[model samples]
Target chain A: MLIIGEKINSTRQRINRALISKDSHYIQQVAVDQVANGAQVLDVNCGINIKNEPELMSWLVRIVQEKVKVSLVIDSPNPDALEAGLKVHQGSAIVNSITAEKNRYEKILPLVKKYQAKVIALTIDEKGMPRTARERFDLAKKLVKVTAEHGIPAKDVYIDSLVHPVSTEPQQVTEFLEALRLIKTLPDVQTICGLSNVSFGLPNRSLLNATFVAMVLCSGLDAAIIDPTDKSIRSAIKAAEALLNRDQYCASYIAAHRESKL
Target chain B: MIDPKQIAENLINGQAPKVKELVEQALKDGLTPGQILKEGLIEGMNVVGTRFKANEFYIPEVLVAARAMHAGMDILKPLLAKSGDKPTVKFMIGTVKGDLHDIGKNLVGMMMEGAGFEVIDVGIDVSPEKFVEAVKEKKPHVVGMSALLTTTMPSIKTSIEALKSAGVRDKTKILIGGAPITENFAQEVGADGYAPDAASAVDKARELLQQR
Candidate 1:
């Protein structure tokens, strides 16, 4: 599974404040925590709230990458910001997202192709985020198809089936699952989630999120926006994968356990 | 001609129309809209949540299910409202100041409403003073604050401090949360409670009310 450390993003208040203030120390600390905790890929979204964004993202990317060896997930809503980010990354990175919107695809895909980076694809369009699961799923299919036509393989794309909370819409959980199942049925299309999204409002959220991770693994999710530092979640994934037969004889789990001295 | 179960399945599969069709059919078949909502739509969501917690569902499936549930809710809201059924709880929520992120806050608000709470949302970039103002005006039993950044986490502390200083902190139990917040942090802030995510927030709120 692809663990995209979401900690490096500037959307979080500390990161945003740090970016606005140009606090390299703070940025480096977050990058360090995300990697040491276990993020295979660090999503660097320099989207500062109430601060400078483009230059900040670039500056952050440079500093955060130095703190860890994990591949970067260059995250930005703006195409220009993404492009700017790509110029600084040392190796193949993952572009945090792409929607089916014509402008998004037109603006972003070239950079993906240029850097040979993977991408997180959202199933929405210029009209905005769809209100229904089918709308989002169908949008994903179309986005995958269109992007594929541009020589970007579907395998290089990670589909984010935006999960809303169950307490609201109630069916959001089910709808996102259906979309995931369908995506799994597709050839070469990978699946991920902004894992934090599922627990958006409930209490003891990590428990629910950990449980949700198991579910996503069941539905063939290949990546996630998550905190690798959380042991409950990481351990849950290992156990779930073993149950799903994704882990051959639980070798990886055993190895991880031994590494942790557990 | 749509089966409610099929609608439930489709909703889980992210087919909103199918769920709506089933809801309408259930309604036309003399089933109370509330019955269709609780049995067909809400019940399906519960299953999705349980499944999600068990690792049997993924984000796409969960989202599609939410969409499907929404399609059905659209048909039931007026009917449910007209029926005069009392909502389960009342809540006020927002993301802490210096933070513009709202998806998590919105999700929590939506879920609280879904879980039967009448949610009063203050939206993003909110200060503790705003929280105090909302509490003074709405008098909700619980106030939920969200922060997506660690730097803004201090703002959560500041909000709690503001709540305490306003002397209204006792009037409304403050529930602090966000990606960076820990239970330890919540206690340090003098908040009445802390929840890590939207769904657990509902459970915790319920637990808090029960304790009170």
Candidate 2:
């Protein structure tokens, strides 16, 4: 599974303080640690200060790339910040999201095409977040079709089924899993989710998150936006991958076990 | 022949219609609204809260059970008011300005209501001035603020300051919560209490109120 590191986002208090102070060392350390902990891609977001986001996004993109060789997921709702990060980003980055909302779709897609980058498309529209699996699937199909029309291949598009918190919406986890299964049927497209969202407003969040990771893996999730630093979640993914026969003869699992011992 | 235990069971299962029916039957069978509320609806919700804290009952189950409790309350409220059976605590809650997220706030409100607190939800994106105005007008025993984003969290402090300026700060206990809020932040903002989640919010509010 593709692991996108979610730790460097500015919504987190530590990251927000670090961003405001332009603490390159702190940002670089977090980037390096996420990569070390098994994040194949880092998602950098600096949306806390909307006015300074463009500068901060580019600065973060540069500092993180300097410390880590992996690609990034430039995360921002602001088009200017997306462009700013994309401009300085060394590798082909993934645009963290575009929705089915007409204004957002129009604004973000051109940047994806312009940068020749992968894109995460959320199953949302002008009407707001879809509540049912069928609604999410319908939006997923629409997103795939539109991105395809924009010359982006299905393989390059990542459909995020948008995991709502199970604490508030109990039936949503089932709906999200069903949406993942449906989204998988769309030829060559990948599926991703923000793993922590499912456990919001609940106790034992990491346990819930790890369990949800395994469940989503079973439902055909290809990537996850997650805190790679959490050992339980990392172990859960490895265990799930081994059980699903995705890890070649359980080689990854056995290697991970040995690595933990060291 | 109406049994409060049956009402509690129906409520625990989120059988709203059954709960309402049992409540009506219990009332007609000469039980006071207070007796039915304490033994039936609140009793069931207390179990729901415990299960929720234990992670056996999730948000949806609690929500439906709260809905069932509300169904029973709708029948008993008027009669309870006429009989001078008032809930001891009045709670006023709102999501702070520039943050529209309210699931946490709403959950806290529902849990408070289920716990027999008179909850006055001022809704989301509420300004500091608006909170001050509500606290003055509602004259609640406790004022709760919620902010889902780190950026919006500072508004909780601002609202508290507004309450102080409006001379209502001493009248109400200030309780703050949200995904981004912590006990340390609560202290930094001069809040009387902080809860990490809705279930705990009720406990924290009760603890704060008891300190007074």
Candidate 3:
């Protein structure tokens, strides 16, 4: 699975305080820490309330890129902020989101094509969050079609079958898994989600999140946004990958154990 | 008659909107606000808390249930205030000095609030002096401190000392928690109690109040 580290977001109070204080060293440390913990990609969000988002996004991109060579997921709801990060990014980055809402494709797809970046398409539209698997599949299909029209390859698009908090709707996990299975049937389109969303508002969230990584693998999910530094999550991911036959002879798993021991 | 039991069931299921609607409906049906609050919302959260203690409900479930309970509380708070009904239990909480990790702390505060405590949140990276000041002003029944980093765990001890110096150590129960904190460490730091997670924190607060 592609592990996108999620610790740098401004939603986190520490990161938010750090960003507000222009604490570059703190930001750099978090960036380095996430990469060191096995994140292949880092998800950066400037949070929702910060003013001067475009500038902050650019600054964050520069600082993180300075400390690490891992690919970035420039996460934002604003097209201008996405463009700002793209301008500063040294390589092909992933646009963390664009929904199926009308006018989103027109605003964000151009940036993806111009920058040659992958995009995460949220399975939501003007009608609001899709409550059923059929709605999710239909929205994901629309996302693939729209991005393809923008000259982006099918593989460059990641369908995020949004995970609703299961406590609110008991069937939410099942609905999301079913949606992911349907989205996987699309030609070459990848599927991903913020795996933590499923366990939101619950106790012992890490256990639930770790279990979700294993479940999503069977549902054709190729990536997740999570705290890669969490040992339980890391162990679960390694074990799940091994159990699923993705870790070839358990070489990586054995190596991981050996490294931890040392 | 609007069934308050239905509200409790909805809250346990994490149905915030439904809980809100049902609470409004119950009020419209002339059910006492106190009855709706205690028997309906608090009763539901008690079940959630019990399930959480048993590891049957995880963080997400507790959060959603808390949110659902909050929906009912939002309706009752103003009415309760007008009627001059204050929560019997009070707690002041913060992440320890140099520790900006508050997700765990916030969870504990929410659970405490759901259990009918008046929680005064001091936010993250709170200094010892600041904690002393809050203790003096808030005069809470309990004080809770959280630290996620091992390096910052000593702040719990330092803050407790500050409380002792301020002549308020015996006035309240001091509880400590976080990723790195343990019951042994809590003893070393002279804290009255330690809860590994948010659910137990609520129960601990209740027990501390009983001791008081």
lDDT of 3 by residue, A143-230 (tens): 9999998999999999998886665567878998999899899999999899776776567888988898889987888988999898
TM-score versus the correct structure, for each prediction: 0.58, 0.74, 0.61
Tens digit per residue, CA lDDT, model 1, B1-212 = 44566656766677888778778888887887766666676567666766665556654466667777789888888998898864656799998886766767866675676565678999888887897788888889889999976457778878877878888888877787887777877887788888876667777888888867
What tens digits encode model 3's per-residue C-alpha lDDT throughout B31-61? Answer: 9888898889988988898888787877767
Task: Assess each model's interface with DockQ, reporting 2 decimals per model.
Answer: 0.04, 0.27, 0.15
Order of quality (lDDT): 2, 3, 1
What are the lDDT scores of the predictions, listed in order? 0.77, 0.89, 0.87
Pick by lDDT: 1 or 2, better one: 2
Lowest summed lDDT across 10 adjacent residues in model 3 chain B is found at B148-157
Highest lDDT scorer: 2
DockQ of structure 2: 0.27
What is the model-wide C-alpha lDDT for candidate 2?
0.89
Task: Find the candidate with the highest TM-score and give its number.
Answer: 2
- For every candidate, what share of the true interface contacts is present? 0.00, 0.33, 0.33
